[model samples]
Target: MSTQGLERQTRNYLSNNVPQIQQHGGNFEIREVDEEAGQVTVAIGGACSGCGIAPMTMKAIEHRLPESVDGVSEVKVVRAGGPRAAVMPSKIDEMDEMEEYEDYDPPF
Candidate 1:
């Protein structure tokens, strides 16, 4: 697929899944998509910023993204709170440096 097509597919996938993510008190922002590299960079924040299950969420994303969007090989995530590390295709980072979720209850 072309770079723009790949990017659009990824962004649309993310947008379509936003409600699911938000229901878990999380939000993902698509930072970029490197088509040549077949990678998607996502910023996850809100309640998911420092949650214990962030890695699980990332794992779910890692598994689902490729199925939802063609040509997507990996999903890289960044948290808003702190210790922002990229969650590569095979590994998830243990980022403990972040604010508690209570601080961002209402993100209006």
Candidate 2:
């Protein structure tokens, strides 16, 4: 299949099979489609930016896209804004700590 055709099929597959993406204010873009190599790169954006579950979503895409899209043997999913855009567990822990200290004031 041609690259454009594969890309369209991928979009349709994601839209129909992954409703959660849109429901959570997230959208995906086809970054690259190498028809010759049978590789497709997708970027997930919007509210999925700092989401903790994005890895799982990416994994699902990696696993499922191939099954649904003919000639797409590999799917590489990347976070739209990259690693800094992800909310790490340490950040959540820090936020929790800040909440605990909300009532305390340091005398300087």
The most accurate candidate by TM-score is 2
Q: For each candidate, what TM-score against the reference?
A: 0.61, 0.75
C-alpha root-mean-square deviation, each candidate: 8.7, 11.9
lDDT of each: 0.66, 0.75
Q: After superposition, how far is residue 95 of candidate 1 from its true place, in Å?
A: 7.6
Cα lDDT over the full model 2:
0.75
Mark the regions of model 2 whose C-alpha exceeds 4 Å error after superposition: 82-108
Candidate 1 residue-wise lDDT, 14-103, digit = tens: 667646567866777778888888998887877776556675566566667788898888887766544443333223343432344223
Off by over 4 Å in 1: 82-108
Error at 96, model 1, angstroms: 7.5
- Per-residue lDDT of 1-108 in model 2, one digit per residue for the tens? 788999999889889888788798887889999999999999887777666556567767888889988999999998676543445555534543443434432210
